[model samples]
Target: MPLSEFDIIARYFAQATPGREDVVLGIGDDAALIDPPAGQQLVVAIDTLVAGVHFPLETDPYDIGWKALAVNLSDLAAMGAQPAWLTLALTLEHNDDDWLAAFSRGLADLAGEYGIQLVGGDTTRGPLTVTVQVAGYLPPGQALTRKGATPGDEIWVSGTLGDAALGLRIAQGQLQADDSVKATLCRRLNRPEPRLALGIALRDVASSCIDISDGLLADLGHLCAAADCGASLHCADLPLSSAARELMSADSGLGDLPLTGGDDYELCFTAAASRHGAIQSLATQLDCPLSCIGLVEAENDIHCHDPDGQIRNISGHGYRHFNESN
Candidate 1:
């Protein structure tokens, strides 16, 4: 017997919808009904992943599912929001039961971890693509934004950089790594963690925050543009995992990769210089490494500085979906 669209939804996607108090009506209904929590503003974001573009076409279905949701979660995290609901729009050329099951499991696992309930979604027969729109809640006037940084604010970032970009290189045969390092890097690339707790903690502490989806330079540029300011970033201060450091050590040319690499999903934020101690304490409390990499200044261009204060030229303003690359 051939599986129908209704059958696929009931068997796989329906189970992925976890119970939530906010969801008055979920799957199987014509539409989902959600009740917003009192005294909070909604934070909504949507992201789409297309096979062979955002990810490799042959990637595992499970990882693809996790990543599709994770990227959207990252956007919420950047805004200091708590994820409450999600809706998926999946397009595929064919209905493969095993693939759908595994994908649902992957999506459910992460959604459950974040307390996100899948309220509703759509499925279609087409090229494989996943689009997720996530809604989160945060106190009114407390949500972080790109427009908050001020001159003299300390710029900081959570976790390491360049691992996912390196992973992409390795996956595309542009670079090679040992089995262990490759595994670790690939996991970083496919299964990014959204820094929700950290975002909430920084809600009142940081002046501005953004999750690094595009390369550091590009995303920081966005933040800076929004704040109508510039930043002075030290090349030596970029946080890097041991693996990334090792890779860069082997080839000095790779040093810029961390600065320009994207998909890190780490929070890059700015706060007042006086809040340095508080930020350090928060980092310790969260057990997530946070580094102060630079200072926001009253200028319009991001100035990349070497340790000795010499300006360094950078290339490519990060990845653009519609821009052709040389």
Candidate 2:
């Protein structure tokens, strides 16, 4: 007998959903019931992943499941929220029991790690697609936003950049990575860590914050726009993973990968110059490298300067949904 929707949920997702105190009612309910903590704000974010668009059609089901949630978590992290619960909407062409099991395992594993509960979701027969909506909590006034930046504030980014972009190139056959660096690059592309802890720690310290879903230049542009300011980025100051550096060393043309590529889920933030020491200490505590790549300006545009102080032309404005069609 073909498994029905209710059967699939019971066999796979029901047991996978974690228990949460704040969740009054979870999976199997018509709708989830959540009780937000008093005085804390609820932060919610949603992201959709379509096969062959956000990820390759041939990508592993487990990776797809993990990434589908990770990306939404990244958004909540940007707002300095503690992940609490999530709802998933899965669209599939066929109900392969094995594939569902692996994907559920991946999703459950990440959810377990973050103490997030799967509350509710929908299942439908369609093209392969996954949409995850996540909710988190943060103190009343501490949720970070992109509008708090000020002129003269310093800009910093967490973790390294460009590896995922390079990995995508390698996957597309547009570029090749040596075998030595292939695994690391591909892992970065497949499994991005949401900087949830770092975001929370920076809640009161950072003047403004955003996650690097779009490339640095593009995402930074958003930050700038929200703050009604411009920015000056030092190209050489961009923190590049060893793998990305090695790949770029061989192909100078790939230098813009870090600036223009997307999928590196790091946090980019601004803070007053006085917080330099404090920021450094936070980095040490988190064990996540932080780079002071630029400064916020009063203007409303973003400019990149090479090591010698010459302005460089930006090739692309990050990934746009309709770019390929146009």
Candidate 3:
């Protein structure tokens, strides 16, 4: 017999991760009762993943589960919050016990690593979709925002960019690579690491911050808009993985992926130039790559400066849901 909705929840979703004291009541409750940490602000974020919109249809169930929660966690990380609780609403076309087991394991593994508890959620029969909501905590008045950047601030991004876009190409059969390179790129697309530690460390350091979920240039455009300023990115200074560099070297057109490709999930932030040393120290301490790619400018436009001193104005934005072109 196929599993019923409640049975599925009990066998797969419930107790996926260890219990937490703050979770007064977890799965099986009508609604989760959470005790928020004292004297801290609450940060909540939600994201929905459809069968083929957020990820490819043929993608593994395990990856779907991980990515669903990871994307929501990325939002909390961008706000410089410490993740605590999560709830999932899962929709399925049909019940498959093996698929549920794999998906639950994937979700549980990441939640366990971060000490986050799955409190409560719902399951229903419908088209395949996953919606996850995560709640986090932050010290009073310490949350990072995209509005504090100044004209003279320097721009920094964590980790290399564009790998996920390349991974998508590989998955879609538009691009090909050797086995090792293929695995690396695909992993990046399927499993993005939220820069949680970096976000927390940056609360006092970054003048403003945002995550690079959309393309780097597009999200940076948002930061600029929030601060009512402009930016100049030095193309030569962009951080790229060896795989990306190798691929782009063969096809110069691929260069735009790092700038306009979404799904990097790294943090893009701005800080005063004087904080260079401090930022560098943080990079070393955290063992995460931090690249100074640009500078905030007084001009109200986004410009890219090539190594040869030529300037190109950029007017394009990142991925949009209703964009017929996307």
Candidate 4:
């Protein structure tokens, strides 16, 4: 007989990891309890991904589960927060044992890697949707934020941009994807590694930080608005993987993905030029790539510096909830 849902929770989800004493209630409990460290504040974020909406229907169950949790972790990473506990609200149109097994394994792998505990949640019948609510804790006065950037701060992004966007294009068959670039870009899109350690290292160093769920320019613009600053990004300085650029050079429409595509989940942040050396060392230790893409400017005039210092306008090219215009 297949294991019952509750037994599955007890066997897998309830086991405690080392250094995770704060999860007072897990699995069977009506609600999980998290006792955060004293003098620390908790940060929270929630995200939802809908099947056939946010993801292609053919998307792998393992990747779906991994991404659901990873995107939430990226939010915590943005705040330089240590992951605490999570609650899931899962809806399934139909139940399949094999599918659940793969999804569970994927979620467990990522949770174990990050020391995050799965506490309590609701499982119900509906159109496929997964909602994750994550909590993280950070020391007072040191949590990173979007509003801390100043005009003189340097803008930086970790990891290659536009791969996920390109991956989507390939997945949709809008573009033919072959060769090493296709394989690399598809992998990046399928499995994005949230820069949690990078976020921790960036605490007190970066003036502002946000994970790139929206396009880089759009997400960075959010930071600018929150920080009351503007940005001037050099096109040459924006970090693009050879895979992404090569793919894009073949098709110009894909170029907008970096400015408009969503789902890369890398960190977009700003720090003072003085801290670049330290941040560089940290990025190296973490084995994460960090690139200086631009600089914060005085106000809302975002100057995209291409050759000849021309100010290119990248307007309305970001992810929007009601963005049916595309």
Candidate 5:
């Protein structure tokens, strides 16, 4: 027998992603209601998490819920939008009330902390999947885009790179790590925080911006393509977090993983050199450090510096749904 709509709601969708004022209507309704503040342009982005493809089958449901919304939030961050509302579409392999409860709890906690509203959603039985659409608002003419980067613009990135990728490696037992470190990296892999505040602060000043949902080299190629330019990135300047550095040092095989591995969600953006100080100030204000990793050169080609003096070229990536594999 099929599950009833209300049963699905109570079992899985109720309070899916917490509450906010903009959630004019929630679950159990024909449609969701949301209101963007006056004078703000709305920006929207959608992402999907597929079980056994996007995430492993043994993954925690709570972390899955957290990541589902977090990835969508990162899209808004790329556009420099303030999050407003979200709509979810969840498909379950089987209705498990315990799994549903945990998922809703995690989703709600993250949304509430971010002040984003869970306006509405639908649920059904199928191959496990979570699709989230997030809406955000920005003042007139203030959203960011990839096409703004230009030759001679400076490139910057927030936080460390590759930890999440490393986390996945650890989770899959491809890399051996102690329990404490393993837990930490896996958490980063599963529950990414979107860089929304830094994005908003950079809107007017940033030349172009994108979240690093893909690996750094690939995502940078995207910005370069949009701005009709190229860049030679400095390998030394890559802001590998302490955790990632330790993991890489422990395993020689992990050298290029940071450059090609996706799921970091940090913002890789560019701005004029003159705005460096302001960018620094904004970073301080947002409580997230920004690193000057490279300069935007002319559209010659996409190059990432090789620490061993062996240069490597990289291509474009944002998210490719059709690929079905990262």
Candidate 6:
């Protein structure tokens, strides 16, 4: 006998993550009741992942579950919010007990790590899709945004770029790598770490901030547009993982991936040049790599510069949903 919708919810998701004090009502309720922290502002974000569109059709259920929640958390992180609650709406082609168990486990593990509770959501039968909504809190008037950047502000990014894009290529058989490299890249594509701590620490230090979901160029372009400014990126300063560098050394054409690749999930932010020491200290304390790759410019155009300071024309503006070229 197959499990009913209510049965499935009770068994697989009702107690997936531990309860939170802020959650006055959780899974069994028609709608969750949350008590926001005193004097704090609420931040909510939602993302949808379709099996064939957001991830490969053959991807593991566990990874799909993890990535779905992780992507939404990344949005909250970008806003310098402390995650509090999550709501999941799962759509499955059919019920599979094993698949449900693994998926719930994946979602619960990450939620527990972040001290977030599963609140309320819905389940339905349809094409494989996962939608996750996360709510977080931030001190009133202290959230980071993308509009405060100004000319001469330094541009920075957390961690390396292009690994996820490389991973996608490897997954689709468009690229090849040794076993170790393959695992490293593919793990990045499947399991991305949201930089929540860094985002929180940057509250007053960063003038503007955004995460690198789309490729650096495209996302940075959005940031620039928000601030009504432009930027100049130093090609020599772009960070790359050892795996990406090694692969690029073998195939020079692959060098462009870091500039145009998406799914890095790291934060791209801007701060005054005067805050360099403070930002460096924060990086050391967190032990996370933060690279200053460029400077916001008064000219309203994004430009790329080679090592010797010559202008170079790079193609593409990262991933676009309905651009038709992707």
Give the alpha-carbon lDDT of every model: 0.90, 0.91, 0.91, 0.83, 0.83, 0.92
For candidate 4, report its TM-score: 0.93
RMSD of 2: 1.1
At residue 122, candidate 1 shows an lDDT of 92
In candidate 3, what are the lDDT values of residues 13-76, reduced to their tens digit?
8878878999888888689888898999999999999988889999989988888888888888
Q: Candidate 4 on 98-163: residue-level lDDT in tens? A: 777777777777878988887887777789998988888899888888888888899999998888
Give the 10-residue window scoring lowest on summed lDDT in candidate 2: 317-326
After superposition on all C-alphas, the RMSD of every candidate to the true structure, in Å, is 1.1, 1.1, 1.0, 2.1, 2.3, 0.8
Q: lDDT for model 1, on a 0 to 1 scale? A: 0.90
Candidate 6 clashing pairs, residues 3+ apart or interchain: none
Kindly report which residue pairs in candidate 1 clash with one another: none
**Per-residue alpha-carbon lDDT of candidate 2 for residues 1-326, written as tens digits (9 for 90 to 100):** 87888888888888796798988888887998999889988899999999989998888888888999999999998999999999999898989998999899889989999999999899999999999999999988889998899999999999998988998888878887778798888888988999999999998899999999879988999999998999999999999988998999999899898998899999999999999999999999999899999999998899899999999997887887878721
Candidate 4 steric clashes: 0
lDDT of 1 at 237: 91
The residue-level lDDT of candidate 3 at 197 comes to 95
Measured with C-alpha atoms, the lDDT of residue 197 in candidate 5 is 83
Report the alpha-carbon TM-score of model 2 versus the true structure. Answer: 0.98
> Across residues 1-326, which tens digit of lDDT does each residue of candidate 6 receive?
99988998999999889888988989887899989999999999999998888899998888888899899988888899999999999999999999999999889888888988999999999999899999999999999998899999999999999999999999999999999999999999998999999999999999989988889999999889999999999999999999998899999888778888998899999999999999999999999999999999999999999999899778787998988887
What does candidate 6 score on TM?
0.98
Q: Please write out the lDDT profile of model 1 over residues 123-163, one tens digit for every residue.
A: 88999989999999999999999988999999999999899
**TM-score of candidate 3 relative to the true fold:** 0.98
Question: TM-score: which is higher, 1 or 4?
Answer: 1
In model 4, where do residues sit more than 4 Å from their true spots? 1-19
- For model 1, the stretches where C-alpha displacement exceeds 4 angstroms are none
- Per-residue lDDT, model 1, residue 239, is 87
